[model samples]
Target: MATFGVLVFPGSNCDHDAYHALKHVMNSEVKFLWHKDTDLSGIDFLIVPGGFSYGDYLRSGAIARFSPVMQEVVRFAEKGGPVMGICNGFQILLEAGLIPGAMMHNEKLQFVCKNVYIRTESTDSIYTSGLEKGQILDIPVSHGEGNYFIEQDGLKSLQDNDQILFRYCNEQGELTEEANFNGSVDHIAGIVNKQRNVLGMMPHPERAMEKLLGSEDGKPIFESILNSLSVA
Candidate 1:
């Protein structure tokens, strides 16, 4: 059976959400892997779940990036395996070099938690394969240090490589400056690397998996991943 490895950091609080999202929602076998373990030879996909890893000190995801499992995540991503990092996981991916840029404190210096719409720019990556370019999704965003920052050249490269995946938007599903959740470069809410298998985003898609709470768009992201892996 195909299995996804979910990395657990010391303070990872969203590992269970990832498991639920992938297993109950996406219908895939999942293995909870410790951060100290570096070997990930058999997992079909890798996920770094969100939470306040390492107490969010030094910087969000800063200390957790040095965890042994990140080495494996990096290796897995390098060889074309799919990986995703949500919220704090996104921060770790950047620090581990699996993705680019760094997340700093929100410009408002506050932790904002609410449902936000995302404007999709790529539907070809493993994470967003079922989405349409320019499509809009309503997902929840919850964090204080999700301000994505990168050098100008890196930002340009992201654009050139089609790495920019999603951007925050308003309730009307329109891209507006007021809806830029954090001060991310070019209003980026998520990104994929050049290989397109690795994806990182600040929004908590797992939180939006149920229609009982008024949203289920996140279901497609995980579904697309499962389909891609099962087919591959």
Candidate 2:
């Protein structure tokens, strides 16, 4: 079985959520990599789970990006290992320059926590290998600074390279402004790195692993990771 590592920052509240989703729900091997640790020995896949890391000080992920383990994470991703960052984890990836784009406060300048629909824009990344193009997923997003922005050139680059993976959309899978709760540029909710081994997204797939909690749309994302690794 492939072993997954969930990074734990000082204030990472979602580490356990990722762990439970992977270990209990998916029946996969999961381990926690503390912020202070520099070694990443046995982890096959790495997840930078969400939460107010470092109390979201200075910036959402500014402090957490400087964590000791991030060095290894950067190295891991550079070596083509799969690394996924969700919500605050996404912020960290931005702060660490793992992916292009900057995060801003919600368009309403308020903390938004609710279920939202996102359309799968691309299935070229490791996390979405099992999903189909234009698939609509019901996932929950809870963040104040989830708005994603990029310069015109950067946006064009992402578009040209097929890096954009998920876009906020209506239940009917329409990319309407009403579905853009965070007002991210082009309704982008998730994106992958140039190599496609790293993914950064605002939605919390870990929170949507079970139908009892809300939706099971998040299961396929995990399954995709496992399936991709097995194929490799």
Candidate 3:
């Protein structure tokens, strides 16, 4: 069975949610890796779940970037291991330099807590292998700083390399300004590293795993990881 690890920081409220989503829903062996630990042995995949890590004092994930566990996460990603960051986790990844770009406050400068649709832009990575291009997923986003920003060259690079994973879209999969929950550059909701081993997204797929939660679109995201491991 594939082993999954969820990194837990001091204020990580969504750690349990991610653990349940992977352990119960995906039937994978999951454990919480505290931020203080540097060891990453036996873990096949790692996740940084959404939460107000370190109280989001200086910045969303500024303090958490220096945590001991992040050192191992960086090494893991450098070796091509799969790493995923969701919401605040995405902030951490950006702060830690695992992925490009930075997150800013929502365009409306208010917290957004609701279901939003994201269209898959690529299926070349493990996170989206089970999904098809242009497939729309209804996922939940609860954060104040989810707007993604990057320089023009970086944006062009991501586009040219097909590193973008998901983009905010409407119910009909149309990219529109009204559909953009956050004013992210190019409406980017998720992106993978150049190596495609690390992914950072603002949406919380774990929160959308159950039908009772209003959508099962998130299931494919987790299943895709398992499928990639199985094929390996």
Whole-structure CA lDDT of model 1: 0.87
At residue 13, what lDDT does model 2 achieve?
92
lDDT of 1 by residue, 1-232 (tens): 6899999999999999889987887778899999899778679888888999999989888899888888778878898888889999999999888888888888888898888889888787878888888888999888999889999999999999989999888877687888986777788999998888889999988888999977998988887887777788
Clash number for each model: 0, 0, 0
The predictions' CA RMSDs to the true structure, in order, are 1.2, 0.6, 0.6
Off by over 4 Å in 2: none
Clashes of 3: 0
Q: Which stretches of candidate 3 lie over 4 Å from their true place?
A: none
Worst 10 residues of 2 by lDDT: 121-130
Q: Work out the TM-score per prediction.
A: 0.96, 0.99, 0.99
Candidate 3 lDDT (Cα, 0 to 1):
0.95
Q: Write the per-residue lDDT of candidate 2 for residues 140-185, one digit (tens) a residue.
A: 9999999999999999999999999999999999989999988899
TM-score of 1: 0.96
The predicted structure with the larger TM-score, 1 or 2, is 2
Better of 1 and 3 by lDDT: 3
